[model samples]
Target: MPDKPRVILDSKQLELTINRLCYQLIENHDDFANSAIVGLQPRGVYVSKRIHEELAKMTGNKNIRHGALDATFFRDDFRTRETPRIPDVTELNFNVENLKVILVDDVLFTGRSVRASMDALLAFGRPQLVELLVLIDRRYTRHLPIMPNYTGKMVNTSLSERVSVEWKETEGKDCVKLHTVKK
Candidate 1:
């Protein structure tokens, strides 16, 4: 039997975590003048939009560069998938060369998506620096060398368990949950 879904970060806690991440980003980027924020497409766009909005409100600069990137076509497993996956739109309209690029995503699992996102970014330009920021980092599950530079939360779980992040815009709520799948 599958176990009941466990709430990892509730709405209030998720907000707090996001706030902390914003502060950390501010501390490092300092006004984001030479930095670009790129949110991964599909689910990651929500978290990236929130972070971009918060950064604007906190820095008093609404002109910060923000875009969404879709890495579907660049994924290594794209050809192996049973169903044909549709590619999402890539919204990056600015150059990334010589700039600090921060990649935002909702979850960091096997690191395959992060790797794919990096490949997808090549069409824009080579960034001087690329950092990853994720809402949830599923520890000990990485299949690649990728790691999150800033993580909202670190969770430990078995390989069969799945983590899901819900946002107000998508699921009508903001929360992180872990589900046990019976294989």
Candidate 2:
């Protein structure tokens, strides 16, 4: 564990970023008319809801499906942790087959979590396409080639640093921060 760093995106900035991201998703895919938002659990879930709210206001439609996914079992580092936590339930009522899926996450770090999320998502159904939406794209040492399709910000960092994304739903605040381990 390491001491957290200074705040990056404050509450106001985070809201603006979320709105921009939702708008970008709509603009990127003209067929967002039939797309679904699937948030990777924990922070991603909160981001999905916020984006969904913005989308509803922009599109004037409230039918877009928002779902949550937990990738604990799918993670490659599951064995590394002494006590593996139980995975949260994945709930997506709509069929994902042939539907565009926007996988949302708070931060894009090592890409291992995104990879695990993909593995978990496959159990639901094969989607037509899966696009990643991340609030902070911290470009550190990546083990995989995974990249985010929609990014609010890109921060170059060292391997010893950590990016933290906080949302009101979970953290009682909306902000993004970068933490570095003190040597």
> Judged by lDDT, which candidate is best?
1
| TM-score, candidate number 1 | 0.96
TM-score of each: 0.96, 0.92
Tens-digit lDDT track for model 2 on 3-114? 8587888899888998899789889775466789999986788788889889988888888888998998888877788988788878888888888999999888889889
For each predicted model, how many residue pairs clash, with residues at least 3 apart or on different chains? 0, 0
lDDT of each: 0.93, 0.86
Best by TM-score: 1
- Model 1 Cα lDDT, one tens digit per residue, 85-112: 8999999879999899999999999999
Q: Which stretches of candidate 1 lie over 4 Å from their true place?
A: none
Model 2: weakest 10-residue lDDT segment is 26-35
What is candidate 2's TM-score against the reference?
0.92
